[model samples]
Target chain A: MIALDYSQFLTFEPQHHWRIGIAIYLFLGGLGASMGFIAALYKHIFKKDDPSMFAWSTLLGVLLVNFGGIFLILDMFVWESFLHGHITEIFKVLLAFFGAAVFNGNFHPWIQWGANFIALFSLFGTLWALSQADKAAILNKLGFLVKIANLLKPLQSVWGWGTIIFGLAVAAYTGFLLSVAPAIPAWSHPLLPVLFVISALSTATAWYMLWTYFAKGKDEETQKVREHVGHQVEWADIALIGLEILAIGAYFNYLYYAYAGGKYVFHQMLSDMGFVIGFLLVGLLIPWILEFIAAKKHIRILVPLAAILVLFGGFLLRYYILHYGIYTYPWPS
Target chain B: MQEQQNKQLPNWVFVIDLNTCVGCNACMAACAQENQTPYWNEKWRTKVEQAEVGKGDNIGRIFFPRLCMHCQNTPCYYACPTGATYKTPEGVVMVNQDLCIGCEACVTACPYDARYRYDYEDVEHNKQLFGEEFSIHQLPHIDKCTFCYHRITKGLEPACVSTCPTDCRMWGDLNDPNDPVAEIVRSGRAKPLAVHLGTDPKVFYVGLDTLPAPAKEEAE
Candidate 1:
């Protein structure tokens, strides 16, 4: 019998709404948020007043998030306002993104929620960075910045706590944004948020470790402290990378073995050789093994390569999930 | 609450007969002209999809006219960040281009792939092709099939429906008991695509299956 079948295999066009641009934003945003949160946790756990690590993490978070925001602006087509000589176009976009998410009773449309979280994370992260500037003596040459940092020093804890809350929200929200999109089979999963959080933590940890390895501190004691930090973060990345591997494996099994929706997503993933070779093997498993060996043998030389691979793997993971995010086609009756 | 409001207004539905669709492309032309859609760029508000069937001597084609499902449970509506994609009381899913930020979330969320970007560039291309004969869209935003909303509300059939030479497309109000198109839907003579998706689409298809489905009574 002749049938007008709406076959899933006949997907002629993949979803191009989100591309590499979005992948970069999600990556940077997740990285920034995780760095900010992890730094706060480190301070609380270590009970240290030394501000270099805290200041650096928060400062990097503010910068990365703002940089990611530029990609969003590039993606938006608000040329109507621009053509009309309205520079407040971005303000309108921001207000709409933030206001709707904040005021809406149902709290719908995950993008707005994501934007709100990112904004809060950036704001508190900046303030936290400023507060630490005076103590860290990194921004001591900028007298007014130091003065402002000192004046706001009383609210330092508030900024730190806000950074943790909002930063974590931003990280998790990036995954949540894709989770709610049911049409895209690859992204619409409960496991996505878990996977993203793990990636965020690991990538951020690897980044800070790299910072310690590279950044030159003047004092002998500061150099020792940074070395200690680099060692500590290497340990954290080992655990975090392990978590990421498990999360990704679970994600694979969930989609590759579940119902048609799950199968549909993995079908696309499996077809793309890059998903396994680029993302799984080179991006994830290789790095995981390297980091494991490095930590076990106390091979400090191997940490940087593993760290860089982890960061690359994190981006590749998101890249595959998004780029291969084929939409579920309708079935003909 | 939307369903409650739909009680007073028309719950518009389309019952499209695939068997009768000759693939004339009249509906496409009419739709493009009526809506000023980006037809030049092959971005259609409504277009017939073709699939070949049978081997050799008995070769035939299925002409499936595709458009926005205007689902009762709209994924596009749920996905809109600024509520730019909204459903009218009369069951028409519409996009408020003014509120649209061109984020393309709704485009990705649509299972039907019905939505497309009708940006300033597309408008500029329209000018190059059609000149100033068309009044440009005020703001660049996502565009999709609106079911000829302007005509339907004024006690007129949708442009495509009215222009269909084969009478393949039928429009009616589901709220009215005597509505013929609604009766076609009620009788199980027609059914919507992707029933499993739970989109609850208002548009229904007829005569696409040559073998006929399990008569909607196999379970019973």
Candidate 2:
């Protein structure tokens, strides 16, 4: 309903020196990266057996999802210029699949390690870029690293910065991203980032567990590997949930502050009116409940569902933050 | 006019006198009118109404006309990914539309929600509003108040300062001790918005008694 207020509105200046197109472009890039992971994960966990399916599927999903949004946002006639978007999209798909196969077995350990390193770098680089966006000097410095592997050394440096660094980079950026526009009072809280990081950690752990469960085979060594992976997954999930509780508590504290200041509009929306019900129902409670059920019965099916729900809820959390914040703070035209 | 023009024009500043000012929203309205700002539905600039110190049975209001504070060390300038927003040598906080990626980094970095996205028009209004081939980049990126830089560059006071019927606003320079701004600071009559924000706001307030408490101010 609220989306109607800002659906396809253009905020660009006709004769201005610059364009708003870049935002659309960057959004697409980010979307590609995120959707890539989603596609890869879904294909790997759900639709296994294409041999090269995992890589191709994930890369294609990421590019298409991200590019699709871009085209729609820009009102580009995709039918007219299908090749423009499709060429790069298809190339990346094939490349991703080929790379995955080449790096599949232990025989290509160095290449596998390199690929993993690149993936890790991309992950942490995104987190760092989000964090660095807060500071001019740091962001400028980080902006210089254009390649994936080049980002790894800096990412390694970030590892020593501890959970707080990762937490601040990933979490605070989430809040900053949501809150900066001011139109979304519901998304304006400082605590949203913390919640985001907790959600991320939870999703990551759940995915790891899902992967291990599916990868298990009828052998002692394989079982041992699966067991270890399972332990890591469970521990990560517990830690993520614990951190989420802390973030939720902080959000309440922020609300109290806002309420006392007579800016209770967002507080009322998030807490009293059941707007955040989905967060509690799907994001928080559902995965928690499913996880508990799985723990008691060892039902492997429930594990994937729990992981999927938790991840879906994480995305929903971001969506709500964006939309609700916009709802609360319309452009004071 | 020639002499007035030749004499180095005192760099204009905005001094908000908190003591006599009532939070009536008059200045804010006048500001929007003078600037032809979009609308409240699209606020380019805004007045932050703060709850001032209250007496036993009486509550007071402080009207802080908040625009881009145009700080010397603007955080938004630094956080911008595309180098879209930056400060000029004359200390105006401005955004370069072409360079802006619209990632909204500068928008987010600012504690003040001063930055906003200007995106593609909705499908229904697309052709009616903008004609065909409506590019998103054709829209504005992050839009904010620029202290009427166009007018200032042409040796005119900002619209908001000129339009304040109550004379609640004053413009001068921080560098010139003879300026009202310098005098006020020297006399310790000047204050700021959220001093603890480490933002080091250049927009100073005089007679700031009507502003809300810091705790309340921070939340807004």
Candidate 3:
């Protein structure tokens, strides 16, 4: 017989508070943060003279983070209030980074911390991306680009490291975002942050693998660099996917025995075909096996395919966590 | 902390005698009129829930009136990112509409499932029903049972407490020794739900063991 502190669960109700906007916000935020971190990590280690995928990765990081902020806006915007609409919401989000009271620390620290990290990462990442040696003559001719790059040229190393620090922090913060809400037992597990951070890193690696592999306008020298970096990224992603599997397995096991509503979530996830087929089979296991085979056999096509699936799996993880959380009622028994 | 800041404000408490509630949803109807809650969407500030309690010989059915517990250790207050939700000196939790950004974190964090979004579209509908201005809901914010913060602060009991035909519901200052509600709670006749959560709810219930045995006929 299955043993439990109490055979009966506390509250068998699934939480329906946060909708799809919050899920998309988490997915985009994690993806953007990790992308920024990986871009800086590559530039310092790989030592590229010309603008490579790393430069574009930083550009993507800035864009993705800014785009992710839109979802947060929609989620938090109060339409009925006197102050409303798109511009005000954007201003409010930006204002929070500049010491606005949007994040009240009397209660939650995760959202506040995440905001600071994203802001810092965006600032440094933009500076670093602008400083890259651009081949496009038209871009270099722009007065602001020339002036900004030249002015900030000396502190390029500091900017690169800043991106790496805050990027990693923002990625990890996404996990802590949901973990702090103890009302949802399925999400309150400490392992959530560990799982999310690892997944973020893996997804970022997958993105780099795709970018380097898919680049078209590269010179012979840059092409050679891209190929070498692409190979290493593929191998790194293989390890990350493996680690992700281990983390998820450990998390699932712990959730079952630890939380009153956790067992329900565990079974609920297992019962859902999306978790099994979409996330596990197609997203994780199959892609993992394909990447391993592609690495061993030197099949170039399989790497991109695996990377695509890995990215899909990464997003699905966020979706399931946000959507499927069940609340266990604390009642007098 | 709230009491220390405002010495004049009395600690509020709600005592619901479960035995006296006759499954008549007068409290729910009264709350709907007073609060203009989203009754059309099956959403209510207060509800009469038909609950099956106990097991074996102890098993009995009862209609329990449920609402925000207004905990001493308020989870919703802590969970709010904008400090929109806060407890007043009188111990009634309230959402400051001006500050509420509608993040819904407070809604998710409340274990009692007390809060709901008062969206923009509903205001237009409410305007059509009961003119432009209605019951401190001009702006969209997280709505919950405020324990009639407006009425209670102005020397009146909550709509539900005042309207109950059976006198099942009681509203009084917990600090006042003369108040019977405080006596009922202190004497251990009424107990708060889910004490393990550490919410320290101001609302309490009595006679949850079984439906009050049918009132005995008085002897001649």
> Which prediction has the highest lDDT against the true structure?
1
User: What TM value does model 2 have?
Assistant: 0.57
Report lDDT (CA) for all predictions.
Answer: 0.79, 0.49, 0.76
Clashing pairs in 1: none
lDDT of 2 by residue, B125-180 (tens): 33344444642224335667777777778877777677666766666676677776
Top TM-score prediction, candidate number = 1
Q: TM-score for all predictions?
A: 0.90, 0.57, 0.86
Task: List the candidate 3 regions with Cα displacement exceeding 4 Å.
Answer: A1-11, A45-50, A78-109, A133-144, A216-224, A330-333, B1-8, B52-60, B187-189, B207-220
The candidates, ranked best first by lDDT, are 1, 3, 2
Off by over 4 Å in 2: A1-194, A208-232, A250-276, A320-333, B1-12, B18-36, B39-64, B113-139, B210-220
- Model 3 lDDT tens row, B93-136: 99987677777777777878788888765555666777786545
lDDT of candidate 3 over A1-333, digit per residue (tens): 111122232556777766677777888888888888887887775665436466667878878876886776657653323344446544553454234333434535466666677888899998887776344234466777777777776898899999889888888888887875666866888889888898898888889878876774358877777777788888898898889999989988988897657887889988899988988888899989999999899888988898899989988888888878777764322
lDDT of 2 by residue, A1-333 (tens): 001111122121111111233223323323333333432333234432221222232334334333533432232222222344444433333343235424434322222232333344344434433332322222334454424324443553353232223223422333444443222334546666556656655665665656566665346654664565565566557667767867866776765666322144444446633436676677777787777777667776888788777766665555444433322211112
Q: What is the lDDT of residue B191 in candidate 3?
A: 84
Q: Give Cα distance to truth, residue A28, candidate 1, Å.
A: 0.6
Question: If you assessed candidate 1 against the hidden native complex, which CAPRI class would it receive?
Answer: acceptable
Better of 2 and 3 by TM-score: 3
